[model samples]
Target: MAELIVQARWLVTGVQDRHTPIGIDDGAVLSRDGTIVATGLLDEMKRLAPTATVKTYPDHVMLPGFVNSHHHVGMTPLQLGSPDYALELWFAGRMPARRIDLYLDTLYSAFEMIASGVTTVQHIHGWMPGGYDAIHGAATKVLDAYRSIGMRASYCYAVREQNRLVYEDDETFCAKLPSPLGEELSAYLKAQAMPFSDFLKLFDQLTAENQGQRLTRIQLAPANLHWCSDESLVALHEKATAANVPMHMHLLETAYQKEYARRRTGKTAVRHLHDLGVLSPRMTLGHSVWMTQEDVDIAAQTGTCICHNCSSNFRLRSGIAPLNAFEKKGMTVGMGLDEAGINDDRDMLQELRLVLRAHRVPGMDDDDVPSCPQVLKMATESGAKTTAFGETIGKLEAGRGFDAVLLNWKTATYPFQDPDIPMLDAVMQRAKTNAVDAVFIDGEVVYADGRFTNIDRDAVLNEIADVLAKPRTPDEISRRNLGRAVFPHVKAFYDGYIGDGPVQPFYRQSSSV
Candidate 1:
């Protein structure tokens, strides 16, 4: 690629160092071969690289591209005909949706994410039906789509050894179901089951194959606490450690998961992971909504990151996470749109605004609430730590990849533009998908002016729609109906077996108050 100079009216570089300011008005970035060479005032950049090709955005605000720290197949469960049931039930209900080609399914969400200013995503793959060969093919298709679309992704197929859906063992749960449902579920489980050794082998194969890819990396995901056996979890940790790759897992996403941890291990989920020697700086816990104070302490001590999925928590009735508490403890926190945002789309700017406001408690003091700069860091720098691209894609600096989004200033700050007001704050509060005029990954423009440069958006959308229009298979219909039948028992298992434990407040009052 040719050297380029990108100048904007205002720039938010996402640099959080104590010595530098976060926003630079009338700034420019000079880049070559996907790496930023300099970022400073436009005049200084012009003086430094006089011959570079110049692209001026007089009506735009540029910043580091948003990183989606945790996600699962791009399609929302609700869009797949699964109502907003609790997490467990929603998993079952999503089985009936017509399956599309993995490439299209992955790209469908990629378009939403990129159009909304997200350039990187940690895609946690789950729920593939076939064994090793089928899953390997699916993984290749998903990664190929990301590579073809010019997006950065950390891909991991979630590993589950024992409990597939609920807290109980698969065979035991199947025994409770009546004839055809039980038989169907049993066969499904049998078809999907692969040895733990095979999963590790597949991880090694994928890592070897994608070692030097520009836009994709392979990682490990243990799925969840209830899903993986102790042996499998240990093996996964060892493999990831040996390979020096990061690990991301779902922990305490719901109250039921917390209860399951308590009943099974006689300790909290975080404590269990700590005891198992899996908690480390390389691990990121997704949707830690129900963590106790002790759990937070353990996480901080171990340097484990927490990814907050604000919208999905509300949609699934998973209670609000104490984000303020996590920040107060000096833990590294990242933001994620687990499946979709409040608008049922992957809009990161809106998700950032939601995260900024959701943790504000009843207080007149400003010190306790999240600041605009802090929330922006979570969406960019801190969020990048949770993925494979630890420090490479989050900031606009001398040595980092040129991943960024340019928001149209007219749409983001209209009717109330004041020079004195903080531009980052205004953009965070008012920005929407419509304002995202251009997006860049690896110093190349992938999306600009409402269209993707790498792929034909209309053709891809038409293909997805055509695939979904097909009638559901008989097996899929049976699975959907069976999921409804089993939903009550799943609820009863939690209610009768676990009961209600201590209730923790969503927001904790400051000690001074």
Candidate 2:
């Protein structure tokens, strides 16, 4: 049977040269066999698909589903109301104390994303131990969760090392550890020890394995700035060159990270990555909010993408990204809410609006620059391109995957000066997460009205509660066993935070099992 959906108003495509609306009224989309076969006026579509079942979305605004280019999906619940501190302090306090389970981990973040109308996301699974076994099991569960819920995803295995004790001066940390323990940790942390020769190898594996799946694509994300080295970064570049997989990484979002990169490499963070030869068309740098002009030029030249997380950057006081400048340079930028904090809200529309308003740099006005629809383009189509699914998804055209969002406009309708302006402006500024009336991926309606077709919402919520309520893992217990030693560092970290607020008081305590 043919499935048809008609909307009174919809963006049939992006705006044309004058940035004026190219969308049509009484727009309709027809699909069969999980593809958009036709899209035009209601009567035309009806004539095209005679005897087909039709669903009229009279007051709903239809648009391409939002794709969140950067996220850490399962890390949401553990760090709620965390101390409004720097990134280092947040990760230090938060990661060590919390425990996570598969079901809860999947449900908490997955539902949050779906609720926010983020049908596609790239979740960098970096928290677990960097070993084959540690990664596959937990990651599989998360992938299964996403698949079950009908969310599209680009799942990345973070390849790099982590320092357990950030407080110990580098020399002291190296010298004080028993040589054997140091060796073991060293081996574990060494980028040379990881599987997958390069980014391309990983991409080749993904394309090889995912023969039929349309919603999920695999990606390559180097763990973090500190975890990867010059050699490892080059390996990544080689892989990117070989397979053409999109490379995403956390970069210069934190002050300490900025300082560390400068002090260690004698260059800015983005410049250092460029020096390592990792800047290219396959690169999607997460949180390039702290980049310099030189860095922006490098990004533009190399055709690198920026996944802008407006709320997360400001919430953590990482400063606003130069969206206006990036757009002027013809660089493609996508909107994102980095996992946790105020970023936890999956509503990408709010994030998109914030991106437009937050970075107005002292001298620019609205008309002098891009419009809200351009930013929405970043959120929807550009986001899909930021990951491995660059060409496979995004726009709602024939032969592309049927990933789309149907928004409810009746609740938030307002008078507009020009009907020619795209619907994105309303969706960005006026609509809320609840306004997402329905979402579809691969022509299957995953979320409709207010419920998930593939998952039990309450059951998922309860699972997250259960996992968080469980006792911390053995490794966590060992870290807690070192609580006395860790406390001094934790205290010092909180004490030196720039904002003059009560540190621990800002955060809600984790509930004991």
Candidate 3:
């Protein structure tokens, strides 16, 4: 019912035609009823929302609020000691050692995210079924919290069809275990798991609730890395296609995964998915860090989006994603934090900087891996597109959703006299989470001046601490034992396999663009 008129010193209306600041003074954006009405010179916008409550901030870069394409937002507790191992062992060990609750943890993570200038997040809610109901309820609470805060999110209630504790015949288990960890270990794990159909039914229930509440929507992710059968993958793809929603999963993340797919299907992971008819623009893959050049080509051809988990990749020693190669192939690559990071922070700016720097080809370096603008797109536009939110929220265009963040340039971006340098570079190199002065989603300020208006930060943290202190689930306990056995083996396997290969780093030959 109320209109908001904001006049900033500079506005980076993320429209491609007008990405740079239009003016140094008197630039404004008008929004009413949670939608942007106009954006232009301050004089023009003021006339559009003449009677509106006006808010102004000078000397800031008003750009679109970042969208984190892939993250386990609620998995904060697990990421605490994350830098110690690779991904498989990390998941195996940490899932058991950590306590996860969808409700409180989600809120705490969301609060952290929003405060750090992330307006939208795609959360991978990988919860086991023993506590399914509680997880669902907690997720619902999280969605409600997001709505109240005016944040956008795409949630994935991760569907893992394999249950480790429920054992099945050696033959069946062997068939599923991607070759290396075969029938022998399969006996230790479960084969008779919940059917994919059951997960679909659960998806239906969740979607029904979504329709009822007008809350945040979730995509259907069939776990990752050839974990689901062909039939299950096909079914899930079709369901997502029919429902007109996005589907996501981890892909080609580790050497073992690539090896597993190669041994089982005689193709790489992305290729295997393409053959299964699951490759499409609608599907967003996470941590495509191990993709080959051919895989990059395939992703380009199929228009499958990828979330580059830079922090997680480096932290787990997963190796740098072929980001430079992917760009050359013209594939869509977005930035992701993936549960752990430089500071366990959800700030995409930090992730972007890491992505830009880490992938540089060593020794023959010339600044070629990625430019600041490229990394910015990975965090903003590209990330939004992966979650099917790009059409509206990625940019701060006049007609698009007014989702933007304000950076306090005085503190974070000092000595800012040059307009020749792209604001993207300044934001990436100099800005910190504390520099995020305010954030607006759907045309309204949700967070500003170092405080959150949606939820109680202290209370959320207390609740998370309480929930995380609870006892582990039975499945988690089993996973812990399995991890203790498998970690040493995994470490040895990796050590033996990837033993001292020539490190090929990316470097920019020229700044043509």
Candidate 4:
């Protein structure tokens, strides 16, 4: 019998097309027990729920909450002492990160994401060094952190069965190094190894644990094309199909990964996945930055989805994803901030602007580049599709979850805004994190006026600072040394991996004028 009504100065229910978004002036949404009952004019919504509690913001604009389709750890790799090395080298570079409490670490990124209006995250968790029970504890802590803060999470333990580092097996790579270093690295890799069945068991256990969860669900991840053996890929895909969940697989993130696929399968990564019958609507490929034209075509034809990690691509030298091409092929693509946004945080507002402006190919054709509605779609409904929530949580419509963000339109447009410019366009261009007035998930105010409702942001941040202030443990120092000693060897493994072949430049349009 619980009910609440939210009214805003402007409301964008969802997108209509590449150019139009279905919005209402003085919009309001009425929800009962976290499920939307109606959306329309403010007066109309009030009439529909006369006795319900109402929260109105006449100077705010409400839109569906953003979904970060691909994410990993709380602290960015850079903060952990990993420079912006290429994706391959960065794996080794990340070894220097100090161990921090999982709950505090999760809150660190959750604070950033929620402040920037991200209500849900695809938390792809993995690469732990321990047995199943230890990893299970870490996973529990992550899920608990999100739940405690009222953030929706679609969690997955990235299934990394082989190729622990580089594109070769761990044993082979360890053998390449000298003693002690080799022995130590081999032991570290072995500590993370468990039977493939253990991965499935973990999934089942996590799934059972989340049977009645309102804010979290377990999903599957194959880690990447090079990390997973073909048999593991097929098994994971089959498990996902049987369980009716989505699988987010990282594929062809770099040229070296693409080269690795060629060496392993004698074909492109996309083709190899296709040959194995793993491409489907239930599969979301993360950072498809190096897919061939044919691969894009196959993905589109098979109804597969893509997550464009715009910031990660830039930070890791992973090259630009063919976002324009994906759109031209009528494919569904979601936006992912990945490690961090352009400014080194999980700012979805900034990520939206980056996605909108980043793909403006030099052209005069209006449809050639991304439009406001297209980018909004990617951030909302399309992004939701790639996660376990799917269509259930996107768009502010009846029968959907009441998850949304209320932005302070007055401040966002403070100074002046032209009437000729569309509202959505102007807001997207001018809005920033400071303008995020409040965030709603499941009809509850999780964040409002720069404050979180369920957790103490400052206290958690200070606790994190206190922990990092203390000296690193002995194990951390040992791992740091191992990471340093193994850097050069790891870098040398990719020598001529992609070959010194001629490369094609961006296609010159037949006519610019």
**Which candidate should be chosen as best, given TM-score against the real structure?**
4
Best-to-worst ranking by lDDT: 4, 1, 3, 2
Q: Report lDDT per candidate.
A: 0.87, 0.68, 0.70, 0.91
Residue-wise lDDT of candidate 4 within 286-313, one digit each (tens)? 9998888989999999999999999999
Model 2 alpha-carbon drift over 4 Å, by segment: 1-8, 15-21, 75-81, 162-208, 341-343, 367-370, 414-423, 470-484, 487-513
lDDT (Cα) of model 4: 0.91
326: Cα error in model 4, Å: 0.6
Against the true structure, candidate 4 reaches a TM-score of 0.98
Where is model 3 poorest over a 10-residue stretch in terms of lDDT? 15-24
lDDT per residue as tens, model 3, 276-297: 8899889888888777777888
List model 1 lDDT by residue over 1-513, tens digit each.
568889899988875631233777888999988899999988788887888888889999999999999987767777888788888777676666666788998998999999999999999987777878899999999999999999999999888887786788889988888787777777777777788888888888888999789899999999899989888889889988998889999999998898899989999999999999999989999999999999999999999999999999999999898888888887888899998888888989889989889888987876678888888888899999999899987989989999999999898877777878677777878998999999999999999999999999999999888878888878777777767777776667566654655765857645555
> What are the TM-scores, per candidate, against the unseen true structure?
0.96, 0.84, 0.85, 0.98
Which residue ranges in model 3 land beyond 4 Å of their true spot? 15-26, 75-83, 131-135, 163-193, 212-215, 362-367, 415-420, 466-513
Instruction: Report the alpha-carbon TM-score of model 3 versus the true structure.
Output: 0.85
lDDT of 3: 0.70
Off by over 4 Å in 4: 505-513
**By TM-score, is 2 or 3 better?**
3
Better of 2 and 4 by lDDT: 4
